[model samples]
Target: MTQQDIRKVRQEERVAELCAGVVRAFSGERDLHFRGRRLHRGRMPLPWFAPHLHPSPETDDFESFRGVADGLALRIAGSDATLHRTLQPEEPVERMLFEMLEQFRAEALVPEAMAGMRRNLRHRHEQWSLAFHHSGLTETARGLLLYAVAQICRARVSGEQVVEETEDMLEATRFALAPRIGHALGGLRRDRFDQAAYAVHALAIARTVATMLHEAGGDDEAPDARQNDTDDKRSVFSLVAEMDREIVEQHVSAQSGRSRLLEEAGAAYRVFTTEYDREHEAATLVRRELLAELRERLDRRIAAQGVNLARLARELRALLAVPERDGWDGGQEEGRIDGRRLARLVASPAERRLFRVEREEPLADCVVSFLIDCSGSMKEHAESVAMLVDVLARALEQAGVASEVLGFTTGAWNGGRAQRDWLRAGRPAHPGRLNERCHLVFKAAGTPWRRARAPMAALLRPELFREGIDGEAVDWACTRLRARSEERKLLLVISDGSPMDSATHLANDPHYLDHHLREVLARQEQQRDIAIAGIGVGLDLSPYYSHSHVLDLAASTGNAIFREVIGLMAGRHRH
Candidate 1:
């Protein structure tokens, strides 16, 4: 074979090596920390390591910077003699130290100042932009230029067409690092202001440029194709009463009596007018109904799976507790484990306190009570609410917190029988998501607005037996706990707006809770620094925690709710 083919093979081999290194770094098989690896006199241990660079043993920090050096070497030498020109051990290290911090202010007292940081890393970049006509690399342009070179080197290493799983893995690392880099720079920028902003902006620019280059080189896979758009509001379609474009004719009945199938398909992709809004367009009306019918059939099939609230919660907890010994793949003991498990592990509340992800303060023990609403109006949302409450309980449990759970509903609303006994006596036959076996299995439909305060009974009274009656305990807990002094008082109320407030305020003109609630709650807030996350499961929260920080799911649904819960509570509540 000729030299060109030989060169390509060599590049692929180099890429393979780089990928193994990156995977090691990603998996924490390598020293993910880069504090001592800085090539400068003193570079602060910044977490903003560039992801575009391939992993290398020659450097401990900033593989992206090394990638730049290698890329420059490759570009300068071409396919011939490129190996000899590769970065020396100390050069890329020095370069990373220089370029990454070259733009920050140098004075310690000044904003985000480091020992010899550049004054607005953008100054040279702005100058470089001005001199786009003439060219000699500037300091600001060095990071940008080196990164482009690194990407080119990456392209050479990872070939076209065939499987580049390793290459994709490396690229994925970079993509994942973008937002992190943004955050790092964001922190420094806030401290230093001008220079930090420029430095961060430059970093973002480098990432974007590298991504575009990688895509253009045909190393990345093509995205899924979709129908094209025909609704050019700029076009006189509505004004002229018709779109005489050939696409319209191709979609309509031509002389051959074959209407254009493309027009109907366009609406499906939201490219052209949606069938739902195409009232005036007769051409789209039939296609719209056809799509609607298809949607209806699919909806019916999915509805069973759609509201698997119980199952979803259980699966999430199981997934969260995926044992370290079982590994990732359910079937495998080993062999390149995958999926967002590590990410989940990192984002887990348990991980936060144990690993000291955000604090050194030791968490104190406290009793947590979960209050559930089992009224009729919340029947549609009951399973979901149970799942959410269960998720939090499991999260707290995993974080080593003791919790007491209770469900409450009134006897007056459900044939004079309390929903609490119905829920308390039952256990779900199957494993539903989170703690669905608790209250989700019961189907006691009563108005949510009833005295559905039975769930709040445990904390209210110490001696009262919870025989499914609401309020007896909650009132007791509030009264008895009033005199006791604890370092932290933690109370979590999970409900779907079903309190005996109307009777308390209207019937008895309840002077007890209404007048004293603000004072009691205010004191509780100071003692606990209360974090009340009210999740109105199905519908709205206007009647519920509209006055507090609610994980309002009024317009959201299933997996989205689960995912957001994971995201929101990931590191929260950890000392």
Candidate 2:
């Protein structure tokens, strides 16, 4: 690489490291990797862990990342051990109440954990309230009420009155919805703000409003309303559009006004678009007999390294063992005598040499997946990747870990809108490429490595190799991995270099595919159970994979590949 390129790579890595550090602070997780500006807490309901709050560009500052972290921590804690379960109300009023209480609860919990969080939380509440002040949506009304209740709770807990308007608004809402408010108030003691009681009160008010709306219409009205339902639908769409505009404005207003170095880098790896039209055709299952023949051939190649494979299996089996074990409390067995407890043994002669250390075999609870880049550039390397995958799969299976081998590449080259016209007009001079994207599934995690032999051998076919799209492939691999019931999962990508798809790259910016790959890796790494690493073929993949190894299969041959593959998987298995 040139000096300028080297410097650029270092700068990108440094920024990415900084972003990861920010995520670790908020998530209480250390092993997370970075992709663009998006942080990941894998296995979360909200998968992407960005610095800013959702739909708010104003909160996109580095400082706001901390607030998001605090919120995430509160959420995790709430999910784990909170006194109240998240309510599920079927009624609109009940739903509103449930939502308000949940929001109030989150704000209340933040201050208890972090003192400084109170100021930020209050500022955020004020921002939301102001932004939605003129929004006429029922959801916004529920949100405003939530803010009012939160202010009251804050005053009670901190012994300081906040803005008087909040108090005024709460009193007004309470009086306006008195009967409904009474149901909620009846549950609370006159003294303090009880979380459940306030939640009940909000639900009652919602129920009352819903009843009023319902009572306003009848059977005759239903038939008449259906007659003009199309008009009503148009009005609903118009309302939705207005709400969307308000949300967009809120995001724009909150947008950070600082340097966007991190954002720029993240943009480099973003998934601009996704194509799924070619999946069914791209993932062609190999014929049974052909698959069997290929597996037999690979088996012979794998059998050549019987000694090394056996040793690896033994080491892995031992490494995957449980950390602790227990022995018989009192029994006659072949074991070491408890010399330190000799006095006790002397008092109880029958207990002599009774204690023994017991060992339990570890469960084979691991899944390994190989994602190969099948772009045309990787044709020569595909054979090597296939061999490596077969050998690794056999070894892992022998070691009792589940394994799958998959491949990703695009179906068409340089096929876009311009190419579409040429093909539709009878392929005059140039035609659009057929089938835009392709993702191959050589083997599934649940399938035995032996059963996947033919499909694995299909990797040798040059015709199938096209343009590679790494991000979507990684995502697809992760989706499959997530379905497995393994405690530990490992995804290894074998690629020539960074993600490249001419159809996409030319259509948008050059770095789009690369950014998406980084994002996919970031998300997969956040999943505590899943570990992702890469083995680049004749190229360095370090820019994308945190744990990556560069290997030249042309020079290394069988033993070298086997050794490196074992080394990579061993590190994962041990941990």
Off by over 4 Å in 2: 1-307, 319-353, 416-435, 557-559, 570-575
Least lDDT summed over 10 consecutive residues: which range in candidate 2?
Answer: 252-261
List, residue by residue over 307-350, the lDDT tens digit for candidate 2.
36676666666654344454334443456664566687768876
Best by the lDDT measure? 2
lDDT of each: 0.31, 0.55
Model 1, position 541, has a per-residue lDDT of: 24
TM for candidate 1 is 0.25
lDDT of 2 at 324: 41
Each candidate's number of clashing pairs is 23, 10
User: Which candidate should be chosen as best, given TM-score against the real structure?
Assistant: 2
